[model samples]
Target: MKIEAHDKQIQDIFSLGYFQIPRFQRPYSWERDEVENFWNDIINDVSENYFIGSMVVYQERKPYFGIVDGQQRLTTITLMLSAIRNSFLRLGEDNLAKGVHKFVEQPNIDNEAEFILDADTSFPYLQDHIQSFNGLKIDCDVGIEEQKLKNAFEIICARLEDEVPTSNSESGGQISMFPVDVPDPILKLKEIRDKVLSLKLVFIQLDNKSDAHLIFETLNARGRDLRTSDLVKNLLLSKIKEGNAKLDSAKESWNSLIRKFDDASESEIIDSFLLHFWISEYNYTTDKKLFSAISKYVSEDEKNANDLLKKLNHAAAIYCKLIDPGAHEWSREETDVRESLKALRLFKVKQQSSMTLALLRAYYEKRLTLRNLKACLRKLEYFHFVFNAITSQRSSGVIATTYSSHAISLTGAKGNDDIQAIISSLFNSLRTKLPQYEEFEVKFLELSYLSSKTKNKGIIKYCLSKQFGDKFGGIDINHDAMSIEHIISESTMKDGLSSDVVGSIGNLLLVDEKTNSEELMNLTVSEKIKKLEGKGYPLAKALVGEKFPESSGVQDRARSIAQHLYNSVQL
Candidate 1:
């Protein structure tokens, strides 16, 4: 590879024309505090110097180093230069203004030798600063917040006064500079600017004509964090280079999925889409770890991985379309639609579950048949609520309550085998219940299966509150104090207990913590049952009449409790 080295004069860097800064480059908007911090860093000598990194410029029909990593610094410098130029114009220093203007103007396409003004370049921030300056007036009432911008302008003016060389002419004539006095408020502006420009910064210049893509990957891999979307884009670029038709088709399909969400910027859509993919396909949870893995993998033989990525992209696109027809708009919402999709995808991948997709299909199909968009939207809202309840940091009790509320609406007086079975039951329930009850049904059903242990606890409480209350004397059903004590501890088991015996819901109880600790602590499930029997409340008889009556054996006892719990809560 060819190697070249030269110092990139601060005044000579070109703008990275028309490219939108990717949203994934930084989180949300930089708040005022961060902006103020940046300003403080510039004013203080903490960071004495800044370098605007080199970038690749598509000049003269060939790509060359334009500006790499220093875009932020370069943009800021251009803003300052523009401010200086405007200040000179305001002060009536026409000649000095021209000199300032020389640094801001764009270079001619054919004349590469022209000393184009850096301020005149088409950088967005530079343009905004210049426009702001031109709009300012001494007599105009500027807001307090705008005072910072005004101060920046005044500082630029002072710096101009300090930098422009004085001129004298022969033939008995002398030129005078602008007459603006150095304001005490802006006295330290020159010092701040000089200190900012004096700090040393290192830049490793790679040969522009070499495999720049590989260099870019290496640079990203070295120390910087690559966002999931960035990794996806890099993978896409690598796939395109591989010259595969299927990969190209998949890319186009993915693009179509993103284009559907026209409200979100491309990067926002892409990032959300990639997050969905990583969670679904690779079962990855953290975005950082996923990006790092993909980055490493793509940096290797990205071409060879094209087929797998294409398949994943295709699956992701279909999933996105199903969940978010509005595409980007749906993804951008604060609601956990992406996470919901991720959870759904994981269910499909890990458990062979298709309830989510089935529900979506049922919703749309039902809506189309009934010609009720409002109903569909309502269902969608309920789905959103249930999904959030499960995925959010909800307490197990709260989740169980929410799930029960939703499930009862669908299953009614009869329960089902699984969530999908409940879904069908729910639709039937919806047929009879009022429209408003639909959400309650969905939420109850969704949370019902979140955790078997949680469900069992809820079940035992429901059974005791309905059955043994008052009959069991002063036994207060404290749901909060209820614990799911294993009748036979798994730790003490020789041959593992069957679901009927120790693992069944019948084997569990909603006993108070004090009773559980004092009477049953360290006891095996069989021992605990024996102690409860001694207390004139045989475990089998306690739950026998409630639901499952076959509590004779250990397995039967477990099943009896679970059956009773399940039955008591069935709508």
Candidate 2:
């Protein structure tokens, strides 16, 4: 573990290297808040030697280095410098612009202009939009990260109030920063460039990739500014030789893995999907230890890095399908599986994805039949409804461990018979893992809906729709085709009944909007029950008319409904 450290200003740091953010490094992810914070730091009263933070890099060649830490800061500073240069360029300060531009980008080996801080992910956009300030003919369909780069550059340009053309839309939406008249723009622009060049950072350089990998985890483990998934990717890709064609392939593979999750959110892509896939394929661990575990895992075997990426790509595709039911192509006959998977997502069953991923892969391999797969998924969904949704038990421990164990077992299943055996075991396990009918009855009895809590409302509707069992899929839960009709109305609360009993699960029934509206509003309990009996809808016949509970005796009726739900629940 050798290290060389120096305190360098932003200008000095950029001057020391032809830097490139590695393929594995995260894309520029600073949002308005971070960009705004950096802007404030630049304009705020500060010392000439004001410190930002440390940057960790490993040498690729004499003047080439790969950024391991502080990429966000470096990328941000580069964008700000480009903004300053744009201001100077627009103001006819050619020499001044060239002076500032030297820090933003320098001539590459072919004498072609190149960005000093080239990001592997956003190079074209960074070059065309921010660095080179080229025209809008270049087309790269913007993803989340690219959009952030555009936004950062946009914010900086607007703040600087440069007449620099912004490559916004095809028509190009360009405007000034403030509505008011500006005075003495050159002095303001020089001030910004000077502040940017003045900012100091601790430049920590390592002689080798191994040392950089070793230092990355320590720097990032506890930092609020860390992106752990990107760090994990760095550790995985470190061993691959730079300038090798395989490096490009590996980088593309990583990018493809990221692209599979295009529809998911940033947190979902970087945080949730990465963490969940690691749990499914490797050890069940927290985000805190995931980087370390992955680094060690990759270090242990030469082939592990490629193996892990393959697993991740497969799991990411599966994960997208798991979280969003419509993500995968389900055949007309496979609607049950899609519907049941959606039900699991609605129930907020996350850890079960560990098992579902394995189960789905087995089905994909033809090792498990669709029938058995559907059965296992339905049971998991139903059991989660009982154990997770209704009882609200801890989602971890026995249940999570059980799913993980079954997923592992499914992977090595010998044949169809073996896969079916695991499926049966999974089904029985889910059934037994459910809260005993008595326990469920107790919990279900305590259920009350509040107008403010959306989940509470959802649960009431869910219970009524599936009063007999898993009769409806997620479509029923999410649609507004029906509303809960209070058998004993909220009006009854004024007549001496309690609010809890009024919104209790026992007093609620799913009814069509018309049936639930003023048409049946003024009816007595018996009248409402009678009105529901003749309706030609599924939820209209949700509860047996006679079993409809009275306002005062809601507890007794809650007990009966609980008993029925407990026994009839399809797990």
Candidate 3:
């Protein structure tokens, strides 16, 4: 790529030509902290020609270029200039304000106002309101971007106000007048304005559009990472026209996907969705390399970009459901799928999600049967229970690779038989990775729930409900039933049992809140057995049949429970 690079002052760059940041570029996201840092940089190096950074742009029309990078700093510089101009206006420095106003905007041949740094993201809010010469316009919706521009202007105004000398000074809670002879505030403000204009940066001018794409990858690679979604959004929408139907529709679709994770950061939500969805369809990838992987897959091909966009749009809703299943309802016939989803979530088994996303997509597309999907979920739940929860094993990265491979296989296969084969392979692979029964039982025996064990809130209930769930008289096993009755209470512990043993899964039971509080609060072994009798729970019968000791009995019971839960797995 051919490049012409030169170190230029901020004032010199603005004088060369009108510049525009592509509309699809990330919005003016520099909030208070970033603005403050910019202000401090100027003030701290008040006397020096401070070197800010580099700016990259490509020629679009003659004398107009598209900003490839450094939009945040450019937008911020414009905001600061506008703020200084407004300050001059308020101080009745009309001539000085007009001089600054010329830099903010210039009159074109058509006699219309043209801002030196045209930004599509901030648009009318930046030009019409924050940088407007006449009056404030509250005509448009003030979204986050608009609000940020408004705030930045206010912040600069406040910072400028802080620099002016006050007539009175406070010492020891007493106010006194200051002697005359402080530097003129207007002159000080002008010094800041000039310092901003002189800020130095290396300017690299790309002669054509393709050069911008060639260099875009390395522009922000040196600094803190650019948000992956931001890069993806820019890549897709750069070639799209501002007011075109395709652009508007695509923008709305992207915005809808964004809204799905309204409560999450775009990086956390969309970035995560893209990576998992990619794993489901393509090969495995990490968050750091997701953008590069995507760019390679969709290289310079609009059709590929559009196809990926549609796939992303489809996967987005499903991705949100995978993260949270209960929020969306399932059909009556898919009750098993619903329960399996809840169980996987409760189990905190995220390694299963990529494969699960694939299975769900196939099922939804009607390419894979519902029965097969349920079987996959069941196998996944069982494997994770043994592998993650019961054995307390590390993820080891191989499990992710296995799931990712199966996830890739599930996509674009012939039919259910093909998908079922993939599912069967996934289970068989997972089975080989499981620990032996002796090892599994030993690890399971270590389970305790005194506080937040297994990264699950109701793990004790999860275990009890899974074991004696049918005995709950059809109550939802997932719920706590308003209470979990901890056997061997304080009195029982005072006798012999340690707290760890007392809180072990074997010593816990899920019962009605009222029953736990009324009949089973501080029961000894005999008392617990008596109260637990006639409860129609086989767990109760087993406990009653054994002569229970405080310490070793819990381990014995845990072993028995482990054997039952572990042996029941189809593997």
In order, candidate lDDTs are: 0.42, 0.74, 0.75
- Output the lDDT of residue 114, model 1: 35
| Residue lDDT tens for model 3, 1-571 | 6788999998888888788886456677887999999999887895568998899998967778888888889988988898888777766667878888887888776887888888755667887886777746768867667888889888877887787532232322211232347666568778988999999999999888766765675675554646788777766654433467456866766677676776454466677788888888989988788888888877766677777877888988888778877778788678778767877877777787789899899888988888877877877887887777767789878988898888999886877678778878888898889888998877776667654344433555666666664434554443545456666674555667687787777776666777777877776766776666656544543443345666667777777778777877685
Error at 463, model 2, angstroms: 1.3
Off by over 4 Å in 3: 15-18, 28-35, 82-108, 114-118, 121-184, 227-231, 234-256, 284-293, 300-302, 342-349, 451-458, 468-471, 475-483, 490-497, 511-552
Candidate 1 is scored at a TM of 0.42
Q: TM-scores of all models?
A: 0.42, 0.85, 0.81
Off by over 4 Å in 2: 1-3, 89-95, 137-139, 158-184, 208-211, 240-247, 268-287, 423-433, 450-455, 468-480, 491-497, 514-534, 538-541, 546-557, 569-571
Better of 1 and 3 by TM-score: 3
Clashing pairs in 2: none
- Report the candidate with higher TM-score, 1 versus 2: 2
Q: Per-residue lDDT tens digits of candidate 2, residues 1-571?
A: 7789999998888887688776656677899999988887777847777798889899958778988899998888888888887666666666878899899778777897767888767757777777875447488778788899989988887876643332331222223442346544566667768888989989888987777766776777677756777677677677554556555766777778778777875654566777766676577777677777787888898888888887887777777887787778989778778877877877776778778888787787778788878878877777888887888888557777777777777876777777777777877877766777777877887778745434577766667666733344433343447787777877777788787888788777776687677578868887776665565344333554445546656777677667666666475
**lDDT at 236, model 3:** 65
Q: In each prediction, how many residue pairs overlap at the backbone (N, C-alpha, C within less than 3 A)?
A: 40, 0, 0
Best by TM-score: 2
List per-candidate RMSD values in Å.
17.0, 4.9, 5.0
